[model samples]
Target: MEFDLDYLVQQLPALRAGLLLTMQVSAIAILLSVVVGLLGASARVLRLPLLSPLIAAYVEFIRNTPLLVQLFFIFFGLPSFGLTLSLFWSGVLALTLWAGAFQVENVRGGLAAVSPGLGEAARALGLTRWQYLRLVGLPLAVRSGLPAMLNTGVSLVKNSAYVSAIGLQDLAGVAFDRIASDFRAFEMLAVLLVGYLALVLSLSAAVRLLEHRLQAPFRR
Candidate 1:
């Protein structure tokens, strides 16, 4: 089958819209997930009496379950319980919860690296536990866990394709829709691969740059 450059070019507007929506959803989810990670990690690290075990359970459950199942539950199942979200918010919530689980582990691992001496010192200096965590622990932990967090961001971006299942017109959804009508599997697939590759690579480059800046303080 001949590759239709003209057809691909003609589809650029739809592809562009899809790409924008994908990026928007990913950005919101990634940002929110990081917040969830920080809070969840802090709770677990501090061993909060009531919250820590529940957070641990949440992390484990989200990590263990399939994201698609989670997505379906949020988008489809929730309506049965009298709670319904718009497709965009539903996608964002699903991705945030899924990535937030991994981010919690990543940030917790970073928090675990904090020296016991520091905690003792904070206590000696009369810093409240919350103050110590916010002023010292989280800053250091976030810096340490940044790479892993960024990796989760990348995965979330790729996983955004799954949002299409809920009828969101993200990149993959647009491509699938076009192929179904035009029967141009080769063209659509090829463009889809390239679009994802470019998006991931761009994200990776940004991650590296951010890492470099964050680690600069530790450099000789």
Candidate 2:
């Protein structure tokens, strides 16, 4: 049988439309994950009463488990609790939780890098705790934390493909559907692989740009 480039080209619009959903879910999840990460990281950093241990437990459980299994638990296991969410929302929630676990680790690592000297120096100079953290610790910590967070965000976008197993029509899901419809599994999969590669490469470039703008002059 002859290959049909026209047919795949015709499917581009639908595929791209599917990509939009992936973008939406990934964006929301990243936003939520960052917020959650900040809260969790702060808990650990502040050694907040009993809260820190609970947050640590959450991070450990999520990090130790396979993400796909976690997705299955949310999408499949959640139903047993009589709490149902749509496929899109479920995908978003699952990704947010998974990403939050890693984000917590990154934020803590960065925050830890804020030297004790900075805090001591600020105190010696009569800076208030809030002012010292706001001016010195937070600024430096957040700057150091950005690259790892961006990398994790990239992973979340690519891993959103796993949502397809639960019937969400993310980019990979649509590609799978097209392959089934056209009986061109190899051709369609190759395109899917390249499409993902392009999206990730573009995202990585954007991350580098942001890093450049933030860091300005090279430290070397």
Each candidate structure's TM-score, on Cα atoms with residue i matched to residue i, is 0.96, 0.89
* lDDT of candidate 1 at residue 70, scale 0 to 100: 100
Q: Please state the error at residue 209 of candidate 2 in Å.
A: 1.6
Clashing pairs in 1: none
The numbered model that scores best in TM-score is 1
Number of clashing pairs per prediction, in order: 0, 0
Show model 1 residue runs off by greater than 4 Å.
none
Which consecutive 10 residues in model 2 have the weakest lDDT in total?
A: 130-139
Query: What's the lDDT for candidate 2?
Result: 0.86
What does candidate 1 score on TM? 0.96
What lDDT would each prediction earn against the true structure?
0.93, 0.86
Relative to the true structure, candidate 2 reaches a TM of 0.89
Candidate 1 residues 152-216, lDDT tens each? 99899989999999899999999999999999999999988888888889989998898899889
Clashing pairs in 2: none
lDDT of 2 by residue, 1-220 (tens): 5567887788888888878888889889999998888778877877889999998999999989989998889989999999888999999999999999999888888889988888899999999765766677666776899989988999998899999989999888898898778787766777778877877888789878878887886566
